[model samples]
Target: MLQVRVSTFSAKQLVFSNIDNEFIQLAHPRLWMQRICKRVGLPILSPHALRHTFATLLFSKDVNIKFVSILLGHSSAAFTIDVYADVY
Candidate 1:
């Protein structure tokens, strides 16, 4: 099992924000990623893809399925296993 130390952040803090420290519109990051992918000649990817990649990477490292399920806010470990059975 992988041991992780989790930290809590302020509820008022925004993970993604504009240069002015204001809330970013929902489409802003997607548009930015699209432009970056176009400039770099890479396939366009969505934010959800990063999330799946994160979970996959964690599973690849032998992290417990229950831990990952909790991190993903899944209702149960079985669901996580079902979704990522190929990873393990």
Candidate 2:
């Protein structure tokens, strides 16, 4: 619940990156995720996989394809349906 609030009010641009407070490199989150996966005993998942999962869940809920397409930054709804036709 608190996580939701922080994300809602705080910077929506970068959740992990603190440009003003800390200097981060590309390898930071990579190593962090590796440690987390090791501790949780789950397969490592990439950002792309998470994004796909989010879209799949929204489609499964019968959300508008055009809305999903917009959220995904796609050029058009037809392309979204073309890529995710199986879900529809």
Candidate 3:
């Protein structure tokens, strides 16, 4: 949440505004992911995987699925459950 706030609001005044995207660009995230994967020698992953991790962690904590779904901006809790039945 803080990250989102910083990216959306505080980022506007930050000096590192040279990048094309305001907050985060797909290229940077992709390159960063690639660099990490190379350093760790793990399978490739996209930034979206972080969202899945968040949902799984929330579900493991027994947070309400509906709330989690909403937090994820998912269309519906049922959709979230379908994707994370293991966590459920």
Taking all chains together, each candidate's TM-score versus the true structure is: 0.68, 0.67, 0.63
lDDT, candidates in the order shown: 0.81, 0.77, 0.75
Query: What is the TM-score (0 to 1) of candidate 3?
Result: 0.63
Q: Which digits, one per residue and each the tens of the lDDT, describe model 1 over residues 1-88?
A: 8543332364555556754456878998888888988999999997778789999999889898899999888999999889888886
- Candidate 3 residue 13 C-alpha distance from true site, Å: 11
lDDT of 3 at 17: 35
Consecutive 10-residue window with the lowest summed lDDT within model 3: 2-11
Every candidate's CA RMSD: 8.7, 5.0, 6.4
User: How does candidate 3 score on lDDT?
Assistant: 0.75
Candidate 2 off by > 4 Å: 1-12, 19-31
Tens digit of lDDT per residue, candidate 3, span 12-46? Answer: 45423334435555477777878999899898886
lDDT of 1 at 81: 89
Model 3 residue 24 CA deviation in Å: 5.6
Strongest candidate by lDDT: 1
